[model samples]
Target: MSQIRKKWLETVLKYKFNHDKPGSPTIWSPDLEKISRERIKEIQSEKLSVAFDYLYEESQYYQEKFKQAKLKPQDIQSVEDLHKVPVTTKQEWLVNQTDNPPWGNFSPLSHKRWTTDGWMMFTTSGTTTVLPRVFRHTQHDLKMWAWLGARALWAMGVRPGDVVINCADYGPAVAFWCLHYAMSLVGCPVIPCGGMNVQRRAFFINTYKPTVLLCTPSYALYLGRTMHDLEYPTENSSIRIIITAGEPGPGIPSTKNRIEGLWGAKLHDDFGCTEVAMTPLGYTCEDEVNSVENPVNVHLMEDAYIPEVLNPDTLEPVREGERGILVVSNLFSEAQPILRYMMGDWTSITREPCACGRTHARALGGLHGRPDDMIKIQGLAFFPSTIEDSVRKDPELGDEFRVELSKVGDMDRVKIIVEPKSAIPKSSYIDPREKIQEKLKGLLGVDVQVELVPYGTLPRTQFKSKRVFDMREQCY
Candidate 1:
């Protein structure tokens, strides 16, 4: 290890082995986290040197890719040169899986290699536009994931003594298993409530009274309502911190406010995907909630993952403050490492200092949306998040809704089918729908058709919410 890495690891081991108490969850490695940009690059270069060499040697996918790109492992030594290696997309990854069964060639170490080493297998939920992507992580990668996960949880106010209830479905997926293990590493007791129904989860929350909750934003609202409907007092629940991942709800101002209002708990967003996750465990601190303006930012753990925002069409870097698709490269992951992977989530990034005193890069609008969710109204393209930001802002609408895109005769059109909140029962949601359509028109630069449906008519999910219904490609 480089001297910087050696010292950094020593500091972390001191905290873990000696049981050193951290002043805050965000203070994992203060010395290195806030280190100068130049210093971080130097450390990143050293780690990348080893990572690239490993990729070149272990996997035929990367070996052939490097040859096709006419590049050597040494040529790309730092994050700056990552562009030289083409971005890996979900399409390419799925093709690799088809070409090679179970684990793709990108898997540096397969299950056979992990037999003696001990590894965990996780696959993408495949809830969105793409097929599921599988990954094999060794014990070392899991430890690293847990460390970053702790950083995210800490920023979200999860302390060592806090008891966390993670309600996500645990599987070969990302959220529950990784986050449960991460909270465990943080010295917090994690109640794995994966297989429980909403009523059972509510019962456990009132009985056990965990201080923190790990779930999707939609589930938080669902569970809280269920608790109330079941005659269980939601206010009496012990949860104070609610962390959401897997979807783009908590980041939406209305959704965030609603989750906070219902649970009486501060909501934090933990963002990452199956490909390259928890490297920085996207986190939100007090600033995300308390800022006078623009506090809704997700801090990327930059110390471990190099993030870039590039135009999806051109695949070139976007201006510093401009919004674009997020592409990430893992600095530490060795099992199934992805380099310059087009993460498909759209957002703008800023290296500016956070109000919460974190210096890591932050995504301003959180996850905007995915490629499959993109829609064109008039001449410009917009994501589901654009509509989500507009729809959730209306207090008359409930947290649930569906956005459908189709060809209205010869013109491309967008229709927002929103569900009314229980607060305004039996009344037509026309006023709110009109209000939302007006706001969306002004914000999205196109007229949007709005229809308000009765509450609970749309599909609701215990996991991630599937809000976009696109029928534009169908031929009648």
Candidate 2:
């Protein structure tokens, strides 16, 4: 290791995960984090004003949108008036981008601005058929990216001197860079393993022994077992913190336990998307609460985001602790401002302070499945996450598994195909097979046929693992 890396690791180990030990910048500032709920609103209101004005004045897209609605930027001064401005749908943004090639009119910054100041263009990794929704951010926005990410990292227990191995896929996708930037802001060494395959990435973990592994919860579990196949011990590795996002794994009880058990490390969950910003909307803390929801229950960084839980049908605000569709407005987004944008995610929010001692609003059960992710079978509706929680409780099953939704004859059917780990002998699949089927039926209220496939049979993606394969032909 270089002198700087050696000194950085030494300092991190010495400080014991505390970043504010004299000269380090406060990503999760104790003063800011512990501020009153009213004070957080005050800051959000102030920034919302700038975001509103910037989008209305500069972007022809927002100007046209406002003109059609006969709404003025001044009309929505505070977050209360945020409803007056209609929600900008993903289709509308895509149409705008299609009409105006490349970067699209969503960007308030001039074309010259891209050339003058360095800018980064990124898109969401959710879809494949449609043109990916792109976002433009200036060099100044890099600070926002770093700050937003580092704030969550601090809460998740990533320190200044730790070595972070990033396993999330790279390229135009915005996910990996945010974690990379956050690690930089905290003054840690981050290894980019997004390009490498699982085997190579496993080698790095065994050799360098990263203190933190950043990836989807599925990938973390995938790596842990893959390492074992290569005779590399992960439970004895240096990894202490595994911060995961991009999919619903860390929050699912069985899935969470599986990843934690395999790596012998704590898991942290985060929430975000490319359209709003490169940063996560919620941050999980290190506190281990007895409640299952508490570990995955994220603290909404209220200072930077205005989050609202709304009924998807009526668009009316829901009572605290009631599950509803999440609607969010960017408080500090300057380049591409999204106000009162429907997140389409199901969740509940409570303003109650967390055990971690922060006054920020907490996501009650983290992200409860998106509206479209809801699967209907024989008049019963359940999310893939619900099934995952059940499947993971079975120690015989590997993290690499698939949830196939298909139509068999006239009946809608759901089947779970799971890979048995090498540790489980072929002779002993009966107990686990029976147990997994029982768990799914008991937990999810739907009888799912569980098949135990051979050890390395299931597909794996380095990025968001596509677990749900909806094979129902379009009847529309």
Candidate 3:
């Protein structure tokens, strides 16, 4: 290794994992060492049966669903038998809250028992079109989150004494809180820059000089721009590991390269959800993510939850290497145990032996995209993530952009609103809209009207960024 890499690794090992040789070939001690395909399936079978019985008896929503599907706890004898249980959706869960209000039949307990040790409530964002669904979690669920998150950081080189800068907002949102809790468990001092102004953020980074920075990939780009504007040299910043979530960055080659180039730090990608606990998937080493196959298996808290993937429409398990919806059930979360809940996210499994020598199954490309994020125009289906990936490659464009879906006559009209980076000068003689149109066409294979919007006119959200607007009024 070069002098810089050697120094960075040394700092990481010394501070984060509390070890001097984290990446040594003989230093393999992952938490998921015991899970093989057979073991995973066996664990899934036991947990599914437990989840099914608990939900069928205690959860009103699942009780009704079980009756509708004619599923019995005994029917779910094996992981294969889990197919008999109907898959539940976020939309259905949202509607359940409406009928029941506040917490729904999904709440696995009487309201009197809600404030118990395991139960914790969180709120997700919903626009005027949808009502925010309040999610419930148990302390056991949170522990699983901490274990997976800490392991990912350890693999990514976060040392114990090193400070980590976190900017993701905290509210009723579970993602933000879970990450903060995870960093604390790792024994790292967390710098909460979530609500700080740009100047304050710069000051915090300068004062603390954290070894790791955590936030969404988009926000990380925004931070880089803000630092540049403030004349703060990122190279001088002590941040060596850049951890990003809410969207893929470390796995996406172009975005990863851009982030690392700008911050002069290593970028690590983490994937997880609010409904399920945070830190489900993450990259530990620097090998090309796709090339370094197996996942961390998350230790499962196996006592807390079980995981599986299936064909969204057919509800049948997909063959290995095929993409499918991710479904999970929690065993210890009596306050609100999700039984075979469909998460809408897609991931492919790989049986290929990982270089890390861990037996846990890996998500081939991290998260491909959410099944519900798909948009069909002119009979062609596409995702906003794909469009964003294409647009981000253009150095002239800013990280902020919006996708508007409206109906033009009987056809769906797709339009893109761009906020160009200041790097591209705003001159009376130049038109950036045409260049955006060309790039979108070349990348999406579809023509879209590109509108130039003033910088900062579009809103920035701390939780899930609303980059896409469905004016067509179709939210399914």
Candidate 4:
């Protein structure tokens, strides 16, 4: 590494270690997590200054971006000047990767360093497009991820004694690996049950009695239901906490309640993306989990990243406590420290100190899906999460659901496919379907056709669930 690059990395690592408390039971980093807002900004400002200089000197992609904006690295020395830098979008990331095949110039990690110190490479699902954007992280990045993940896990009340069972496929995705390392760091024994089927996973859970279950929210519900099918009731199981990621869980009350109700466990969720995969940027705290009246709050780690809520169209920062798209400027990460990357999640943030005593900003009501996932029907726009919230509210409905949008004559119509609980008789499906349709209509402000499928007919997801299928173009 160049001396300048080495110095920047050392400075970043020093901040991380200085504030980190790996062995703390209550707060992992009291100095960072519970520090005053002014101190947090000061640290961010200092880091931002160093980070911008490093990015300008190292990353060709960021260097060109700075040149195009007519702003030098010194212009963005503080958090106040972040607005001067143009927002980086996923589209730009995809285009850059296409132009510079394989690894993109967006990352500062050079080929030589990546060959020697590279840890892992992760990619987006690329469900809509042909080429998925890829990211390569270094060993230093992994260490940062583990430490940050440990902080998030600790805040969620995870301790050394808790045994965690990770139910992911152990794929290239960042969540499982990050959680695994964090679990190891926290001194928790992890049972890697990735490739196993639901039956086999249930067998392990029943026999081994792991204290914590880690998987996506949909899978948690499916697993809990499957446990019941296998005559191993989840309520009777020893799993006390279900930590979910990859999909919206605790944010949606119905989905959160359903999983928590089924597993007889507390359902906690952390929010992160492929680009900013160093840690769980937003996490559920104990206070948010226990509170019944206020909407669930996912605390944003302000010290690690600067989060801004911007209007989707105007691209301007929204007033505090107002809903807008989430944009983050990652101050951490050795390989890819992104600046003002649009995360595109609909959420409002509040810097109010959480009842758990952490003063970081909280994403009120959690992430409400992305703008790209928003479904427009007859002049009305709503997120798929809204439908999910309504679908999971009914106790008699199954865990899986599909929303199909088609053109009925000249009008846009939505059809929600849902399965009745296996325990419920086929004759009783009509009532639950009607109830779900009514609830959805009230929530979505549009009448939707509700289809009742047989139990186990809809496919369950192990990772992120794809529930919406817009067939309007195909129908036309």
Candidate 5:
């Protein structure tokens, strides 16, 4: 390795080891997690200085970006100067990868390091029209992932005696793999349910008697309902905690209550994207979950990450309590420590001390879906999560619903297809459908058609659920 790269890695690893407590049962790292706000900012400032210098020296993409912005590494020495740097978008990375093929220049991982010490490659789902964005990590990154993951999991009350059942497919996605290794570090035995179907997974929960279930919020609900269909009551299962990622769970009250009520387990939210896979950047703590707050908060790991909330329209910082999109700077990884990367989730943050005794900033109400997923119709804009909150609030509704959008002679039309629970008679669907429509109209300020389908009409997913289908001519 080059001298500059070696020095950068040594500096970051030193910070990681100084504050890490891998064996703690209550708090992962008291020195870091419970430190005063001033001390936290000092640590971030020092690391940000070194990280920017390394990125400027090694990463060609960042070098070009700095040149265009008329700034140098020294210009961004503290959190106060973060606005001088341009915010990075996913589309920019996609274009760079398209021009460069396979891996892009955004990351500092060179071919030599990748071949010698590469750990794994993770990619986006690529469900949209664009190609999937890929990321490669080194062996050094695996250690960071394990340490940070262990801290977040430990805060969520995962102990040595707990048996975790990971239900996500062991694909190129980063969440499950990171949690798997972290569980090993935490001394918890994990049941890898990657290749199993929902029915088989439900069976494993019954036969193996795992204590913790890990999957998306959608899959958790689907699995729990399927267990009911197979006569395996989830409420009676051994699972005590359900750790969910890949979708909004604890943020939506109706969805959170439904999952917790169905499985008789506490639902914890783990938030992060493929680009920021070093750890669960946002997580729920024991106190946050047990609090009487209607919508529980997710704490951001500020020591390992710097989160900034920017207005979606102006790309400027909003007031502390105001809602805006999230942009993060990863200060803890080896392979892909991206700076000012736009995560695009809509939320607000506060630096007030949490009841859990952590001084890090918490994302209020968790993340409420991304701005890219927001839908507009008839001069009104709203997110699919709003629709989800309305649909899931109705007790007669099943676990599946979809928002279908089409054009009706120069006018936009939205139709919500929802399934009634099997116990509800077909004749009784009329009341529930009308109720859902009324609630949606009140929430969105626009009229929408509601269609009631049979119990098994809509399909269920073992991964992240796709709830929107836009069939407008403009979409084509």
Candidate 6:
């Protein structure tokens, strides 16, 4: 190991070996479920108020915002009073950047103070039109991220020593690098093979014979398809478990089942973002499905931050089970304290006790796609995730596909390009094109035309896959 890596492993081992002192719950705890809802709310409210004070003093954006709202920190007396404070929105961040280019007006500290030793920076993929945001982490952030990852791995039933093949990308991406670091913490030997070089990936799998697989859903499907073409028994391979993240598929039943059946591994899902430091929303084995029973308590890093969710339309608090935009308030981050910062993803909060028995608020369905991932098709809105779900259900269709919109003559044409699952007798198989089209019409209430192509036609993605290729001029 490199000197830095050696030091990191030493730190990890110290933390893991010393974790039995009893400050936090064990990997599984039925008593955590018994904690009353009111107590959780009380803790949440206290953290919010503390976060508000931190932001008001440190961030210029929140300072001005509070001034304009004509509210004082004392006015936010209780957690219920949080409703009186205005809701943060994605537009605020966009507008702030427009008002102040590069680092926005909300930036809390000077650029120099943000420097750290043995730290890394990860950039977000600008999903819509906004420029990508950069997230910085110190050695401390790396440690915390590793801790949560260790928890996630343990929940997946990963023992102390195992060989894990990390299929996530490298360089500036957090998911790929952070996960590898975490696996190292748990004493799992990690192999980083990112990108979509199918033959090479297959070669590595066959040669290395790893016990655990880490990859995104899209790439997982691609790898599975490559193995299938070679007549390899991928499902019966040596890999025992697949820990998935970046996009929600390993957790989604149909996609999960297909991957498991193809790779012969159990799938576990995780959720996180570049903006939230290194902590993640991970799955533990105590639940039936990785439900909203448990979540990483980054808030306990009250020394570190606070998190929230709000309704985008009404700027009101969404009740548990109601979808809303995710907002965060970083309490302890003095270098760049984000107070009431709005993150554009959509998901619901669940306050109920989970089968696993943790009282921490759970994002019930992971991130239910982003708010901006919606597209209008034949006057109805459709999310690509929904389209993907429909397409993947049919085992016959290859996972690689794209949605393209174009103008032909007087009307708008919606075209879905998909590769077939296998090269075997196309005549004997029902065309997945017609099948997907029918489902889109039935589920999305919009008529869409589907096009079929040979396997390996669509370009593979390493990180976030582009599901749509809009070719229409007038639509733009």
The number of clashing residue pairs in each candidate reads 1, 0, 5, 0, 0, 3
Candidate 1, residues 1-476, lDDT tens digits: the string is 34433443443343331123344445666655566778767766666655676677667899899999998857876767778887888888889898898777886775566897766777777865366767777777777767767666667777877998889878787766767877877789988887889999999988888899888888888889888888877766788888888877556877777787888878878788778764435778766765645338888877577788999899999998898889988776657566788887888989887767777788996775677767766688877776776666677777777887888688877888988777775755346766788888888888789998778788768887877777878924
Residue 225 of model 6 has an lDDT of 75
Tell me the tens digit of each residue's lDDT in model 3 across 1-476. Answer: 23422332233222222222234332223323334668656755665665666666667788888888977656676677765777777788778888887777776666554566454677765533366777766665566556555555665666777898888765666655666776776678888876777667767787778888888887777777778888888866788888776765665555666677788887776666655544444353544332433322221223234556788788778998888878876544445556667776777666654565555666665664676677677778777777777677777766778998888777777899888777765773366778878877777777799987777777765545667788886633
Model 6 is weakest, by summed lDDT over 10 consecutive residues, at 294-303
Model 4 sits at a Cα RMSD from the real structure of 1.5
lDDT (Cα) of model 5: 0.86
lDDT agreement with native, every candidate: 0.75, 0.75, 0.65, 0.86, 0.86, 0.63
Q: What is the TM-score of each candidate against the true structure?
A: 0.90, 0.90, 0.82, 0.97, 0.97, 0.82
lDDT of 4 at 160: 82
TM-score computed on alpha carbons, candidate 2: 0.90
Would you give me the overall lDDT of model 6? 0.63
lDDT comparison, 1 vs 6, better candidate: 1
lDDT of 3 at 231: 85
Model 3 scores a TM of: 0.82
**Candidate 3 off by > 4 Å:** 1-31, 127-129, 277-306, 424-436, 453-459, 472-476
Error of 3 at 227 (Å): 0.9
- Report lDDT (Cα) of residue 235, candidate 2: 82
For candidate 5, write residues 1-476 as lDDT tens digits: 67767777777776775234553457888788988999999888877777887888888898999989999767888888878888888888888888888798988888988999999999888765467888999888898888888888888898889999999899999888889998988889999998988989999999999999999999988899889989997887899999998899988898899999999999998899888645799999998887768589999998888999999899999999999999999987777878999989989999999988889999998998887788988888888888888888888888789999999787888999998878777775556777888888889987789998778889888788898999997754
For residues 155-236, write the lDDT of model 2, one tens digit per residue.
Answer: 7878877999988766887767888987888779988886788999999999998899989877887788889889998788
Error of 2 at 34 (Å): 1.2
Off by over 4 Å in 4: 18-23, 426-430
Runs in model 2 lying further than 4 Å from the true structure: 1-27, 126-128, 288-295, 474-476
